[model samples]
Target: MYRLHKFLWELRRNPELAERFRSDPDQTMRDYGLNEEEIRAIKGKEFRKLYQAGANPYILLFGAVHMGVPRQEYYERMRSQS
Candidate 1:
């Protein structure tokens, strides 16, 4: 979870890292040492799963936004999981 949070923080603050992630998410996630569950949640855009896994909602939303997911879509995805 710490690794996931760190990666999310970096993804939010570091434009270069975000671009690198956008280019090759699998590789970027692997490089971040994220486990399969974390990688899957992010790659699959499963925001609710991430939240359930204890990610801070604000960080998750910011990271999702950096990845081009709209705010409404993020909320929709989160609600759909309920």
Candidate 2:
């Protein structure tokens, strides 16, 4: 979880890394030590999975924003799951 947090943080702060993530999220997650499920969740843009896995909401928001998801759309998607 900590590693995922740090990995998200890096993706948020670094443009190059963010570009890499946008281009190939699975590979990026793999390079960052995320497990297959974690990689799948992120690569698939399954934020609900990440949240259920104990990811921080604030960071998840940042991730969603960084990935170009509209704020309202992200909120709606998350809300629908609850």
Best by lDDT: 1
- TM-score leader: 1
Per-residue lDDT for 10-67 in model 2, tens only? Answer: 8789999999888888888889998888887776668877898899999988978887
lDDT of 1 by residue, 1-82 (tens): 8888889889989999999999999889989999988899899999998998899999999989998899999999999975
Tell me how many clashing residue pairs each candidate has: 0, 0
Which run of 10 residues does model 2 get worst, by summed lDDT? 73-82
* TM-scores of all candidate predictions against the true structure: 0.94, 0.87
lDDT of all the models against the reference?
0.92, 0.83
Error of 2 at 54 (Å): 0.8
Cα RMSD, model 2: 1.4
